[model samples]
Target: MSAPTSNIADFLRWLETERGLSFAGYPELWRWSTEDLPGFWSAVWGYYGLHHVSDHDEVLADATMPGATWFTGARLNFARQCLAHTTDARPALIAVSETGDPVETSWDRLNEEVAGVAASLREMGVGPGDCVAGYLPNIPQAVVALLATAAVGATWTVCSPDFGTPSVLARLRQARPTVLVAADGYRYAGKEHDRRPHIAEIMDGLPTVRHLVSVDRLYASGAAPDQLPRPDVTRHDWTELADRRARPVFADVPFDHPLWILWSSGTTGVPKGIVHGHGGIVVELLKALGLGVDLRADDRYFFHTSTSWMVWNLMVAGLLHGSTLVLYDGSPTHPDVNGVWRIAERTGATTVGVGAAYLMAAEKDGATPAAERDLTAVRSILQTGSAMPDSTWDWARDRLGPDARLQSICGGTDICSVLAGGSPLLPVRTGRLSGPALGVALASWDAEGRPCVGEQGELVVTAPLPSMPLYFVDDPGRERYTRSYFDVYPGVWRHGDWVTVDADLSVAVAGRSDSTLNRMGVRMGSADLYAVVEGLPRIADSLVIGAELPDGRYYMPLFVVPEEGEPFDDALREEIVGAIRQSLSPRHVPDAVVPVEAVPRTLTGKKLEVPVKRILQGARVSDVSAEGAVTHPDMLAWFARFAARLGSGRS
Candidate 1:
């Protein structure tokens, strides 16, 4: 095959011939980037044509964890760079939602909308360091609101409208936003959900919101939130304020100024609000989109994600490098497992992104997008959210076409961008992420802290990157932030994943290491177990936890949600056990196979394994999570009560 031609390759070629800087391969380029961080970053700023209000004198001043600072003496507005690209030259965005049809927003109009909102927000006394929270869907208005907040140097945070009141309040209350931009309701699965009552609860719970701007999405449905208590503090007509000012006044702030606040899963205790800066994110996304994903100036990118997910932020960041964004809102599997592929076909997207769970469901649904749909425009298929099973790679290949690449990208909400994933320079391998993301000093360290290659160990970043959270909101002295990552490995950032760096230098993630399953001296991930179990047609979903008994025997309980109306009979149990033994080792079989009504998941769709493990291991339910933050709070009661019965020796 011909050598891959990408923006990074071209940039590298340019450096060799024009700038007299030569590198033989990506490893050398990576080394130079991590070693001389200043040179690497300055080159990124120049290469991407980022707009800066003032020049940066120092690329990185401090390198300490939770203390690192980048782009010293620089001033810029992230919104300016995001808007600088063009609505006319390249299509800015095409938005499709369950509530409405596809709506295309040109760069010029998008700029106008952002400017309009920014002007109103500034007039409302929002400025640098202020917070603007949104309870919104993945719609155009959410994008506009976010850019407007960034344009005026205000910190932006968001929660999906689908989240319960307590979940939204857990993070937004800590942000203490001056404005809360929300929706009256949203549609999903061919049904409209009215959120006006939830909006009232959120507004009442948060005393800091000075303005309530509600997007009238249910106009045709004719369902609106109740009248505002204080007209001065709230407004239902979103257009009135957006039209009030069509010219945005941009604000230039320090490089380290907070740009957005993202929340943790909140499965344990209160959620943590992670703060990330403008310059760091700008540089990081520019490289990530341009090099890691090979997004060209005109490539149309579509990632199936909610506004609440960090991938939503990446959808907006595509604008930074002049990539067209197709923002999608609604259930990916609403109409069926093929719904997301239909979106790619309709938008003529060059890249299609979805979580591994979506792919698994599509497999179960027997979806065949390649045969049923025309996706000739798609060039890359991106998968994340969970580890992509080796078997699932075949499923991806059969549906996405042979020409298109299927990349299992890995990143987290904490960074808001990929730390390891596909690269144009690397060879694509089935079931393995290509390698460490450029500029990230990643290594797999064993329990004794020795670097391990071709073996599973803790994932760690030995050096600091710009996109790591600046700090956690409300975390004084960085106490929570410190314990979250650094406490495990001292100076190194422990990413909490069981990762194996293979001999080929490719990376394979084996789920979270803290919840790693060990039996008879062999260690396996819970994801490994679920992969086999969920593949069975009888199993809709499953959760596995290795509970340690006082007598030192490890009790492995497999909780499964049976398929609708399907009886949990002896025949089904035998099949499950046979599959596990055939696919995995004999010891991989569960000690107890229990059927449950539902499996607890986060609002973002992650299985609640760690929290469930603690509950099953005799920890108090209250210690695991607060009721409101959990997606299925009542479902946890079954696990807790079961644990009690088991502990009392009455089961």
Candidate 2:
């Protein structure tokens, strides 16, 4: 994988001449990341066609988290921009369920529905700064209600319907939402799961909620009743709330006004409430769509994500780009294993984004979409949330048509857009993220805070980007936000990704900074362990964690999921350990090899290592049980038993 000699300037020129993009599209974007960032970002707000009431003369009033005022004088409604180019007939949302009939909402109809919902909220005493909590699926109702909340100047927070009652209560308690929107039930894997009971439990726990609005999709007859009550709960049907009202106008607010409160998946501790601002989020989303993904108005954008993942927020940006958003609310491989590819073929999705885990699953299942379906409409496939293996790229090219671009995108919820990804103008590399986003100053720095190439180091952004989180909710003086990113490197945002920039300037991801195991004072990323062990035909997936023995020595424990029906024998374990020892170092060899059925993962499909470490330590693990454990829960039990055996010197 060779790095293009073309810098941001050359890339922009190629975009203009070869890609046929306008030269004036995003000059500030190219200049700010390399030159004056503040000016570049200030220009981005106007270049992206954002709607603001007043022209902001100042780019940033302060640099501190709590004191930062972006577009201080500017006043605009976030919902207005989302609804700006919408038409009456254009499909705003196309929602398909797992087992039931599909539903569609036109742009004008969606706008009207949002207005009615907003009117209902206003009538229910909901006001600005009030939180509107949603415990629903990725249905059209959720989208409409979220937009309505933004239109009414209320902050919105949502969790997927799959979340357990305790997780929902924890998030709603933190946000203290006044209005709670839920569904009667949802379908997953051809089974209808009743959410009414979960909703009741959540309402009982949250005394702050004043209105409980329920979408009637779960009713046996699909009838929209006025209200349903059980004990202290009274639910208002979503359809009944939709009454023709005068086109509800949007409320103008400052650019830094809070739009939504998103939570960090609580795999270790309580979920942190990260608040995002209007101007920064809007500009960042537009840049990601127009510049990063090169989304066009006529293209149909599809992503396999729930409301829980950050990709959902990024995918919603396509609506702002005037592209039809094709949303599927079910298992990626449900009804049949080919559900996602079938959806792509049916929708003619030009740009499709999916988590890397799904690609691995496709490889395992021997799924080939290009041979079975017409994928010519697909332009690029954006993959993130986990490191994509080289094999996944080969499978994509071989199975998903040669013309399609395979973009290895890497970013987090903290930034809202990818820091490193592929550009359409560049040639596709095997496993590396083609390059950094135009305005992102992404580089690898060593432990001594010196920039280094061809070696693994911390991934840091030297300059500020608009989409960075403004502040955490209720964090007095922004202490936590500062400590999270800026505490490690003064004045620099250290994204906790261990990466190596090769001599060719191609970046290869190691793993999370926190999860990097230190054995005998040598830092080893877990991805290195997986790359070595999982490459063997006997292994399916594995989780490597550094465990402290009772003797106070830290040792690496490897839990592997073997290929089905393959016996996990001592001979195979020796081979796995030998592979790790030879590929990495002798210290990289696992102290104990435990074969497990599955690995625990967060909602975003990231391995939950911290909590697994806690369970190994024999501490009462509560956080693991809080959020709906997506992976097989028995893996924790297997880990506990394995750890006990290792503790007793039985390995």
Candidate 3:
């Protein structure tokens, strides 16, 4: 086996030597990659030494936006690709928890467990096209279950135990998995949550779940699996399923075979079950993580995430590069404000990825994690979920020292990979993404479908990406899929976020375009407002909502959650208004500054700007966001009450 080097460098060398292609820099390489998608993607397949049972001349068969077919004749399994790179000496997984000490799972152990579970699944009649749903946490067992499902050619989907029963059912019922694997409970914030009852409710809701596998995390060895809820349902322990001595065998399914289902945030409605194929994920992850993020075998990749979030799925792909994955199953700031940093320090994590909100809050709290912990091993600090403020970015750079590169990445669960993020060859910039990812024809397009530069516009992809969803579950006619992405631009994938592409191609993403704020004929993104508002010392968090009333009058309100003991008095409000007027513009200033207990966010830590705007515009709470999909559903009621008092008839 050939040794792994810097993947992007290696690919560039391969392009020059094998393909007779040479580029001066990343910009030229990226341009060529997008222009010749087939050549670039085929090179990725070959450079990674991907093994397939059948070969195909067509890298991408159909270039249609919603129904693009890729690598049709090739056959491979995601499990095989994930496990093939690592050696016996390297650890496959490092599982850490709030209460328990860190445990390392070797590649041999992982393969054995995967083989055992795959055999057990085959015995239970699970096969190709069968769905195996997981209501598991971020643990080794969850990894084992997903790999085993892929090994047997069964599709896999998962939800974190943190999600309530309704949220779990809302997503899982769409897939209708034949087998369900769930943990007995999970621990978070120094507390244990018994989810057996919640699991029962989930089982009752998903009648298609014929076999139930229980992972005993909170229970003892003598504990028995729960009784089957119905006569047709059978119960099995996770350990029992993984105890058999068996050899690993992978099913060589077609390249476009369903691998996994990832759910949208469901902030607007029921989450869409996005299905991605095996070859697409395998190829894309190898490129996105290996090239874009420069992940290496010696690197311990740790991304603070839950199973419900897409980052967890992306983190598992670290195994594709023979890198060890560090999985933490607890609150980011549980034992202390620097808990996550401590985890990185102890694990010797080389790459750390976390939501931007965490860094912002830590900056507000005056946290100096570098001073508190030894983070010298860290080489890259990836921030996602939302754009970071300039001040927070500066603070992070200063705190982490000069060695770590701070990268702000923006993507969605729809792709289950990065659209625009950091590349090893690109220079780090403050409060801006590096550039469009290679093989992504990303652009900022105005309403007229004209590309825009140095100005905010709809983020659109003019070409089909391999990692784009094969199809949304239950959307047989592709109506939902088309309407979701290609509806706006007609044949182009219009990601909902607003972005600005500089002449140099560095991208800056504002908040969601749908939630953009327009006042007195002046337009601005919510993220621009947040970058100013959240940077204030007195403000702990904030949300801005703009609603057009029945009389065609715009009502914009800036809701601020004051820092502890900091009141939203006239003085503070005036400061906020003055800051916006100075930093941005007087035309974009809010009509009112209302203090709130907290700002509502999705489970993944995105502010509920659009949903709250709908609530303030007199929309029903149920019509806007699913309760289970939100971090604080109770805030929806408060917003509704405030709307009621404002009255819809007000001018």
Candidate 4:
């Protein structure tokens, strides 16, 4: 009906004329990319005009997972690429929160600050291969610290300040960082929280920390604003480093050297520590930002996330493409559900990003963004962290208005990039991802490991991608690394997500594969039930589990948390059941509709379905639940008592 509008059309034309590519359109180019792996990635590095100190001897040396090496003999510094293209005083970073006005820093200023921070880190005796950890909010200081660590060729790890002492110690201790960076405190939801006590507990648990650098946010100037109990470790103030204005030193390292560490949510046990490299991240983000999101060099990029989320790390990579970043630290709903929308309008963000849950909440609040805010410059809105309901897509259309495309991306900490997401040349279908990311080798495999199209199965990457974790921290002998991905399908990387790919290449992701509900030999995702139940006005949240008994019988119970003082009657239950049966299938309906106080969820908003299912199927709660992993660990007690009573009753 209309011509296709793409931000990357000019780039594609350049590839055709300059690179001598014969591909005509997006489909042909996509096929060429997935088929000729080396050519596709090499074209990306070249097209992005990335600077390197030395040329790569080979594009891909070995094509093996956990063993694949990319850009052999290439020597480059990540921070250098991030700062290479920008030369003017234009804003490179805009930091905002719920409390104050947005702070803008120019590209030149960011370069100088990063150089000074890197110099400060060197003065602390940090060198190549050393580890630096950030226990801070999603502020500019966190980004500066990460870039400084990368500039020094040291590994960086981060956790949000919102985490409790146990959560902080459980993750940072495994990295064994010799240096730690944190803020004195942060403001959230009309309250101020001091991190001094939490840092004391964390430092006591981590004996390996030699240097502790504190960012003075809550207290701007003072020698004793926040004192640490661990007097043995050297402490440096963030303001002091800026005052010195020392020059930064860049390190030239191998392609596969560790750049940062991202942890699993650790709900079941100690979070799985994943280590990613510089070259892999640089190349991967170049493709993801350039082609997948079609992000421009001058565009303002914003993603609402804490430092704890993997998306925060990805947002920092916006610098790699010279995209100005708009960093927000406070709660997304601090003043109201419209906080993020205001930031997008104020920043003139070409692309805005947020978790799927945030959009759902705003839509539920009856937010009309275009009417309430100035969104003239907004072109696209990216949502990830989970599959979005169809209602989210409809709401974004009405709220953001025309020219703002809703991109529902699906990827996680495992790959550090998207598996299925936005495509400029493709149509954005409601409740469906645009398509597979270029060069992802993405496919859906059935139970017997056969690749299937138009059928639901486990999402697996059959080939190696640059951004996959090289290995896990403290996982010597590659035992955990191999078992986490490869053990499921030998060489193929089973990403643990259940997805369906249509014949036209569009993808619809189900929930986690391990948490899929099977009803009388029929398999369905738990997300499907949530898409039906949570849309109701009376229901606040829902959790469903198909527990298998020792006698091979399934107990399909649908648990719902009703709104405050809202009644849950048989009429409402039947309405929910009828909706599921009509939209999905008769087999998809739950056997029982049970009311609960609250459904258990992880701190990151993920339902603890698999772990809760494990607990219901005769496993101990201690083995299935972690203290720091859950949002409401107290809520788990209700589930445990309910599971015990299930022994005497039937759903």
Please give, for residues 45-100, the per-residue lDDT of candidate 1 as tens digits.
Answer: 77776533468877888887767888888888788888886545766989887555
lDDT of 3 at 566: 89
Worst window of 10 by summed lDDT in candidate 1? 219-228
Q: Highest TM-score among the candidates is held by which one?
A: 3
Ranking by TM-score: 3, 4, 1, 2
The candidate, 1 or 3, that scores higher on lDDT is 3
Give the per-residue Cα lDDT of candidate 3 at 644.
Answer: 84
Worst 10 contiguous positions by lDDT, candidate 3: 220-229
Q: State, as a TM-score between 0 and 1, how close model 1 is to the true structure.
A: 0.95
Candidates ranked by lDDT, best first?
Answer: 3, 1, 4, 2
lDDT: worst 10-residue window of model 4: 221-230
RMSD of 1: 2.2
User: After best superposition, candidate 3 residue 379: deviation in angstroms?
Assistant: 1.1
Cα lDDT listed for each candidate:
0.84, 0.76, 0.88, 0.84
**TM-score of each model, paired residue for residue:** 0.95, 0.91, 0.97, 0.96
Alpha-carbon deviation at 531 in model 3, angstroms: 1.7
* Per-residue lDDT value at 250 in model 3: 93
Candidate 4 structure, TM-score to reference? 0.96
Q: Candidate 2 or 3, higher lDDT?
A: 3
